[model samples]
Target: MTVDPELLIHRDADDLAFSVAARMITAITDAQSTGGVAEVVLTGGRVAARIYRAVAESPARVEVDWQRVEFWWGDERFLPPGNPERNETQARDALLAHVDVDPARVHPMPADTGQSAEAAADAYATELAATISALNDEKRRAVPAFDVLMLGVGPDGHVASLFPGYPQLAVTDVSAVAVHDSPKPPPTRVSLTLPALDRSREVWFVVSGDDKADAVATALAEGDVPAARPKGRNRTLWLLDEAAASKLT
Candidate 1:
């Protein structure tokens, strides 16, 4: 069966956060009942952080098998640990710090690799292969389809580290790659390639703000053919606030 992405928009950021928290807990519990573990890939942004905070505060979060949930970043800022711009650091402050998850399983791309971006990219690819190998299933070697993926849409129709007008945005092989000259800021980052994204069973594009309305409409209306837009290649749901969805017909 094909997994379809769902967009559940809320009135504002707080409601959006709470809704995501409730669904994440529910999804984890449901998955855990059928299987022993639940793996989740996460993204970083104000919206994503809100979901993390909500998860941290929710009572059900403590009940889930924290030890059994292996965490992975959908994309990470290639900055030193503790850097304010790093997704891992943001996640830590937002929720990970409060959870009892296994430190070893929290797969935050190591930014301290003593090498150039190209070398670091290669190292991260190797790391992904090893992690997936350890977590593979009978049908798939390395990275059984993820239970869910929480993503943040950029103003320029980018998700994860796939920036528009860049060749990395069109990458297929190698699940992860190091990004340079990201239009946003802190240009350097490590992101999951399109193939890696296919690992998710459900992908959510949690978006807010008026500035993103144009990009939001473009991705959703442009269709899922990669030729149209970067976000179009996968099963994606555009969850937008009033301002962001205002222009949609």
Candidate 2:
């Protein structure tokens, strides 16, 4: 385990992405060496977008057996297909679309926005349950263990849909959840619950901005304050650029 959030302070966005790309490459190789296959859960945000693009451009990324990998989303905007705000759409354009991973393995959150968030939540859970059942050796309802999970920390200390002061963050029973009234923009969305997210062997929270500096300090200050500073946890990482790390004390 890392003593701190694996701080990687870079001078600019490009340097940040390169560092993230390298770390991600290491994660992919580690997963492959251990399980012969890798299952990754991806997140969204400005920092993540850069990392996604960098991974796409990385020459070393081709070393992984893309065909043997599966992809999942941590959160998704409840928007129409191809909507600019949708995380899935962004990932498709940024990374997945360029990769050779089988189309069947890319699991985006259910896009039943026309339906109620509750209904969409159930449907998303069902889809993941079916996939997990098929993938697990012990006939589980959830994926045995996600190889890696990448996330973006909202300034409000939200990770995925586990937003601060939100009731859903305390959700202990469900693996996936649907969110309404998001404190951020585009109110309706779906997300993996904290339980679901922590199932991953490795979790990464990448942030890069001056605005996020305070949150970074809180999250790393040593307390189980996911709602206050979602960065607290084990087997997790916070990859930050110099701007985001500036206020850490």
Candidate 3:
């Protein structure tokens, strides 16, 4: 059930981070209240790092049973595990490490281990399918219906490494795919395809800075950008700071 996207403008990046942190905690708690584990797909960016730190430092952090929340990444750099550039490493240092989360439930994309990017993507897809199969009786999708799927819009209007005009944007058969020769640095990555990202109850786009304002506005206007493609099942939220929302009418 695709729905209209909602715009939430914050005073600044700091305010945006704290607000998102609170909202994330509440969302996780609400999902758990329904007697199911909270499945969250995390994104990586400067703004996201701030949000994670805010979550770790929030006084209401205890409201969520971190161990019951499953953490997954929307995309990752194909660097080795524990590399500072890896989203998993940043997330762990900023939030997951501080919380009492079950390490077994934190699913990061496969790192470069002498395997081809395509092979790594396939491995992650298999892991995602296995996890969903264990939790759901209906075999409808390879990925679970995530409680909250967070994403960061790149300056080029990319989300989860799905760059504008990239061929991967048209991929629908797989939950995950390998991205080669990325427009951004490192050139290689593994990302959840649009089908996988759209399998979520809430899709939150956490963006900040004036550099992203044009992309944000373009996406909200339904322009031909990758960021405009993925819509949440229940809600689509564009959580932006003032600078990021400045270009929006």
Per-residue lDDT of candidate 2, residues 168-218 (tens digit): 887888777778898778998888887777677667777788888877777
Runs off by more than 4 Å, candidate 2: 1-5, 138-143, 223-234
Model 1 segments more than 4 A misplaced: 1-5, 138-143, 223-236
- For each candidate, give its TM-score against the true structure: 0.89, 0.89, 0.97
Clashes of 1: 1
Candidate 2 lDDT for residue 191: 85
Q: Model 1: how far is 231 from its true place, Å?
A: 8.4
Residue 65, model 1, lDDT: 81
Winning model by lDDT:
3
Residues 1-249 of candidate 3 have per-residue lDDT tens digits of: 889999999999999999999999999999899677889999998989999999999999999999899899999999997999999999999999999999899999999989999998999999998887777764345446898999999988999989988899999999999999998888999999999999999999999999999999999999989999999999999999999999999
**lDDT by residue for model 1 (116-158), tens:** 6666677777876777666675335343577777777777778
Per-candidate Cα lDDT values, in order, are 0.74, 0.76, 0.93
lDDT of 1: 0.74
Model 1 pairs in collision:
132-142
Candidate 1 lands at a TM-score of 0.89
Clashing pairs in 2: none
Model 3 residue 89 CA deviation (Å) reads 0.4
